[model samples]
Target: MPAATFEPPAHRGLLTESIARRLQNEIRSGAIPVGAKLPSERELAVQFGASRNVLREVLRRLEAQHLIEVAPGRGSFVIDQSTADARSYDALYRAGRPTVRQLIEARIPIEVEIVGLATSRATDVQIEAMRTANAAMIAATDPVVKARADLEFHDTIAAAAGNPVLRIMLSSIGGMMFEMMLRSNSDPSIAEPGVPHHPEILEAITARDTDRARHHMREHLSLALRTYGPDLDLSLDVMAANHIETLLHRRSTP
Candidate 1:
C-alpha cells in the first residue's frame, strides 16, 4: 500500500484573510483550545469557502507562530499550550507597551468566551475561588496589588474551564494580558471603587447562565476598552514613527 498525496483545494478568494482572521481569533479566544486538532485543510477550505492553498497558508502562518503544529501521518495539533515554551509561544501583546485599542480589542473577546465556558463548567469551589480573587481586587489600593488580583480572577475562571490545555494556552500570554489591563485601567473611571466587573462575571457563572456570563464579561471588557486617560501609551504609534525617524536620522547624519 502507498500513502495518499496531500491535495490542495482549488479556490482562493479575497475572503481568505478574513477566514484566517476568524480562525486565529477563535484560537486566541480558546474556542479551540491548545493541543486540540483543527479540521483538515480540505475541510477548513470548504468551511471558509476558500481554496485549500489559502487555508494551508493560514495554518502555516499560525504554525510559524507556534499556535499550531503539523505532523506527517497526522493532523495539525494546536501546540500544547501548557508547555509554556517561551521560545515557541509569543505573548499576544508586548507587556507594559501596547496601544489602547490593541489591548482592549485583543483581551475582550478571549476573556468573554472563557467566562461563557466557565459558566457551564465551573464547580462550586471554582466559583468561590473566583469570588475570593475578586474580593482581593476590590480591596487592593496599589496598581501592582490590583493587577495581581485581577490576574487571579481571570486565571481562576480559566482554570474553571475544566481544560488544563486551555489553562496552559491562557497562561502563556496571561502575564501580558494583566499588564495590558493595568495600562488600560489607568483612567479614573476604572480606579473608582466598585467599578471592576469581575464580580459581575462570577455572579453570572454562579447563576449558571452562559448568556449572562458572556454578556457581563463583555460589558466588563467594553468598559475597560472604552475608558481612557491622557496617559494612555501611544507608544505603539510612537515606536512606529520613531523607527522611520531613526532610519531617516541615520540616513541624514553625517
Candidate 2:
C-alpha cells in the first residue's frame, strides 16, 4: 500500500520552527535523551501540533545538526551531540545551540556588565523600551511570549549599554537563549522566582545606580541556574554569589 500524505500546515515555516525549538529543548533537557527513539512521525506530528511534512522538516533539521539520526526503518533517535557539523547546522544560531545552563553562565558576566553600562548610559527612550518589554512579560499568559519578553528586556539593556560589540555578542546567542527561556518560563517553579527581578532590575537601571544595578542583576542572575535543581553543579552561581557579597562589601567600605 502507498503511504498516506499530509497536507502541510498553512504557516509551515512557523510550525516547523516551533516544533524544532520544542524538540531541541526536549533533546537538550534529556526528556528525549541521547539514544532514545523518537515517537513515530505521525505521533510526533500530533504531539507537536504540526503536519507530517512539517515534522519531517524538523527531523531533517535535527539530523543535520547532529542532534538526532534517522534509521531507514527503525525510526529517529536522539544523538549524543558529540560534535557539531557546521556545514548543516551553522546558520541561524543553530551551529551549537547552548543549553539553558550554558546560557546562564554567559548571562552572568555579560549581562552584569551590560546592566552596569546601561545604568549610567541609557537614555530615557531606552529605559522606556525596557519598561515596555518588562510590562509585556508581566502581562503575557503564554510561555513563549513571556520568554521572548524576558529576553527582550535584557536585549534592550544591551542596546542601552551602547556597546555594539556587547549587543552583538548577546544577539549571537539570542535564539538559543529564547529556547532556554521558554523551557524555564514554562515551569511555574522556576519562572515565578525570576519574574519579579525584572522590575527591580529595571528600576535600578532607571535610577542610574551602577552598583545597585549590577548588584540586582547579579542576584537576579544567580537565581537563573535554579532550574538545574539542587545537585546541579552551580559553581558559577556560587562565584556569582561571591561577587554579590563583594559588591555588598564595597558598600561597607569606608
Candidate 3:
C-alpha cells in the first residue's frame, strides 16, 4: 500500500482507526502477502501524513486483531493464515466483513468435520496446542486476548485435521469469527455457560472419540446463535468498540 494517502472519515479527526482498518483490509486480502514486511514507522507516517505515534497506535490495533506480528528489532510482518495450506480465500472477505450468523453457518459444517478428522489424525503436539489455547481462554482477562484464544482453540483442531482444503476454508472466516468470539466471550452471562465446552470437546478429541467431539462442537457453536440473537454483531461489539475507543484515546494522547 502507498503512503501519504490516508483519508480520515469526515466526522472523525484522528486517523488512527482509519489507518488501521485500511491496513487491515490490505493484509486480510493478501495484497501484502503473508510474511511481507510493513513499512517502517517513519515511512508509514510519511505515507499516512500522521505522526509516528499515531502510526504506532495503528500497528497496535492490527497486532490486537492478530493480523500482524511485530518483532522487536525487525519490522512488522503479516502472519500466515494456514501454515501448511496452499491457497487462501481471504479475498472473499474484502468487500465487507461477514456477520456473526453467516460466519457461524460457514464454520459449523467445516469445523464439525475438521474436528472429526482431527480426532483420528491429531498428533501429540497438535493436541497440546489445543490444550494450551483452552487454558489461555480460561485465563484471559482482556477481550482481545480472549477472542484470539477462543479462535485458537478451534484453529488448532483444523490444523490437526491434516486436510489443507478444509483448514483453508476454516481460516477464511477468521476475522469475523474473532468478532463473534469477541461478542460472546466479552459478556460474563453469555460467556459462562460456553466455557466448559472447549475442554469437553478437547477431551473427546484426545480420546479419539469422534462422535463425542462432534456433539460438543455442535453444541458449543450453537449457543451463539441463540444467545446472540439477531443483532449480536452490532450490540455486543459495542462493548468491544468501547474498549477500542479507550485504546485510541490513550494512544492519541502523548
Q: In terms of lDDT, which candidate is strongest?
A: 3
What tens digits encode model 3's per-residue C-alpha lDDT throughout 1-254?
A: 33444433321223564577568768867798998999999999898777777788889877776778899999998897554342244434534445556666777898889999999999999999999998998897666677789999889999999999988888777756776676677666679889889989999999999999999999998887778755546532343355355544554467
Better of 1 and 2 by lDDT: 2
Score residue 207 of candidate 1 by CA lDDT.
Answer: 89
Top of the candidates by TM-score:
3
Of the two candidates 1 and 2, the one with more favorable TM-score, higher being better, is 2
Write the number of the candidate with greater TM-score, choosing between 1 and 3: 3
What pairs collide in candidate 2? Answer: none
Off by over 4 Å in 1: 1-98, 184-186, 193-196, 229-254
lDDT of 1 by residue, 108-174 (tens): 7777778888899998999889989888977765444566677888899999987777778677666
lDDT by residue (tens digit), candidate 2, 52-88:
7778888998887677889999999887764545222
Q: List per-prediction Cα lDDT, in the order shown.
A: 0.64, 0.71, 0.75
**lDDT ranking, best first:** 3, 2, 1
Worst 10 residues of 2 by lDDT: 1-10
**Ranking, TM-score, top scorer first:** 3, 2, 1
